[model samples]
Target: PGMGEAQAVPYLMGHVPEGVTAGTHYLQAISTGAVFMGAVTYIGNAPNFMVKAIAEEGGVPMPSFFGYMLRFSIPFLVVNFIILSLIFF
Candidate 1:
C-alpha cells in the first residue's frame, strides 16, 4: 500500500476500466489510529476535541488530515525501511 507515485500512478491509470486517463484519476492512502498515535500522544486518541484545544493553546495550527500525514508521517514512513533493517538485521 505504501507506493510511490511513479509506480502506483501508472498501474492505476493502466487498469482504469476502459476509458479513463491518468489525469482523471486520483489516489491517496491514509493511516488512521496508527499514524495519529505516532505524532501526538495516546491522549490524542482518547479526547479528540481536547487535542484540538491543546494545539490551539500551544499556537500549533492543525493541518487537514492528509496535510498532517504528508508533512509529518510520510517522512517517518519513508525511513521506516532503514529502521527495520537496523532492528532486524
Candidate 2:
C-alpha cells in the first residue's frame, strides 16, 4: 500500500514530520479496508463489470453480490492472505 515508503521517507530523510503524512497513512488503511470488504462481497472496482459481462455472454444469470463473493472471492481471500503474510509478516 506504499505505507512503508510514505512513513520511511520522512523518518529516514529527517524532514519535519508534518501531520499531513497522516493522509498517506489513511489512504493505505482505506485501501486495505476496501480489500477486506471486497473479499467478503463484490462491491469494488472492475470485478463486477467483468463478472457481469462473462456471465451474460455465457447465458448464466449473474450471481447475487454475496454469492459471487462466496464462490470466487473467498478462495482469493485465502490466497491473498497467505501471500501477504509471507511477504510482509
Candidate 3:
C-alpha cells in the first residue's frame, strides 16, 4: 500500500500510468524501460554524472551532456531502448 508503486506493484494503490495495469509484469517492464531510457542522456541518470566526475578527476575528458548524447547515447543507446520498449512496453 505505502509506496507500492515504487517497486512497480501499485495494484490499485500507488500512482500508475493512464492505461497501464498495476501488476508484476508491467512493473518489470516499466523498471527495465526506465533503466534503458535513463542511459540516453547524462542528466537522465545520476550515476552518469558521478562517473563523468570521476573520469574527469582521473584525467579522462568526458563529453559534455549534449555531446555525450550526440556522440554516444543517441548512436548507441536510443535505438536499443526503442527496440526494448517496442518489445516490452
Best by lDDT: 3
Which lDDT tens digits does candidate 1 get at residues 1-89? 68887899898867778865544322211343345345443234556557867897899988766765677556775467446445644
What does candidate 3 score in Cα RMSD to the true structure?
6.5
By the lDDT metric, which is better: model 1 or model 2? Answer: 2
Candidate 3 lDDT over residue span 1-89, tens digit each:
55555565655444555776548787888898788787788888788889999999999988998898899988889888878778877
What is the per-residue lDDT of model 2 for residues 14-46, given as tens digits with 9 covering 90 to 100?
875556464665676567656765655655667
* TM-score computed on alpha carbons, candidate 2: 0.40
Whole-model lDDT values for every prediction = 0.57, 0.69, 0.80
Model 3, which residues run further than 4 Å from truth?
1-22
Q: How should the candidates be ordered by TM-score, best one leading?
A: 3, 2, 1
List the candidate 1 regions with Cα displacement exceeding 4 Å. 1-44, 47-49, 57-59
RMSD per model, one decimal = 13.8, 8.9, 6.5
Per-candidate clashes come to 0, 0, 0
User: Which stretch of 10 consecutive residues in model 1 shows the poorest summed lDDT?
Assistant: 24-33
Report the C-alpha displacement of residue 10, candidate 1, in angstroms.
Answer: 54
